[model samples]
Target: MLDWLITNSWLVWLVLFLLLAIIEMMTLDLLFIMMSSGALVALFTALLGWPFWLQVVVFCVVALMMVLFVRPVALRHLRRGPREQATNVERLIGEQALALETVTDHSGMVKIGGDTWTARSSDGTAIPAGARVAVERIEGATAVVYPAAGPGPFPAQ
Candidate 1:
């Protein structure tokens, strides 16, 4: 049994690679895939009839290189969406809204794109009703805002 395991070491590496790849698919975090890359290198080394310890060394080096270098590049390319494509929440960040009532730092109401939202003044000052305002950011269920008259990088409605 022991001799079979020793001679069939590549099979072990192949199983490990498959297992790690499955885990990487489940996680989608790019961690186990890097390790699987190492296992693949070890499998190739075993197929070449290399010493077990040398195969282990090659695995370690390849895994480290993949984790330290390749993973970041892969994450950068695959994980993040294009900057211009905003999510539903992200789309509201710079949207213009109409103050439905006097908005202070504590509480108020506003209509953004025909939907009413809990609102707050960004600077703690009171904003009168019917004023045009820009959505600065969102905190919990509240929309923090400022007067649209001020200079800001946010787009106009």
Candidate 2:
């Protein structure tokens, strides 16, 4: 079996390439894909009657080059777009809210976008309930807010 493998080494390279490709699909990290490219080169070298050791050396050099050079360019191109969108609590900043309770510098509550959140005065002043406020930012679980101009005077009821 060992003698047959030594003589038909291209089969080994082919099997290695397939294994790397399979792992690449599972990981999606581009590392195994680069290794599969090296295995492909080694496969060609084996078909050309190169010694097993020489094929291994070629595979190592090619894989290293791909990882160090090609992978960066590919990742940069793949990531070429607008910066990542803000998520979760970050989306609350700059929104307007209604003070659900008398919001003071130390503690308060506000209804923001249909959700009630703990809030604090941005300028350390009290904001009465039913007042309009703008979210300045978030600190931990709390919304920091400042008084927002009220809506134009209601039409005479």
Candidate 3:
């Protein structure tokens, strides 16, 4: 069987390629598949009457080129994607909510999107209870806010 496989070199290459492809299917990644492509090229060369050493050389060159060049690009393209943003602060940007707790000196707490968040007024003014506030920025777990247009601590007097 070994002598027959040696004499029929193309058959050896084809069988090796099939085995590599099977492994690739089991793994579901691209590394073995790229190497299998190089093996297939060598199989074609052997079928065209190239010497055994020449076929080996072709296989080595092709395999090296795939490993050095194509693999990085394939791995990068097939990598898992980043997750979506899903925090309360992420949802509060550009939204307005009522100040549940008073800000005596530009600091307080507010209920935005049904969640209470530590807050600070953008302008140096006190935010009173029942005042509408707009989210200006997120700092750590806190929300920097600005009082909405209307009567606040400084009523339009």
Q: Estimate each model's TM-score.
A: 0.64, 0.53, 0.52
In candidate 2, which residue ranges exceed 4 Å CA deviation?
Answer: 82-157
C-alpha local distance difference test of each model:
0.89, 0.88, 0.79
Model 2 misses residue 40 by how many Å? 0.2
Per-residue lDDT of candidate 3, residues 1-157 (tens digit): 8677667989888988998899999997787888888889999999999988888889889988998899889888766333345454565676777888885445798877667888888776888987888888888977888877764332121
Candidate 3 lDDT for residue 89: 55
Q: What is the C-alpha RMSD of each candidate to the true structure, in Å?
A: 4.3, 7.1, 8.9
Whole-structure CA lDDT of model 1: 0.89
Question: TM-score for model 1?
Answer: 0.64
**Candidate 2 minimal-lDDT segment of 10 residues:** 148-157
lDDT-best of 2 and 3: 2
Compared with the true structure, the alpha-carbon lDDT of candidate 3 equals 0.79
Tens-digit lDDT track of model 1 for 35-78: 99999999999999998888889989999999999999998988
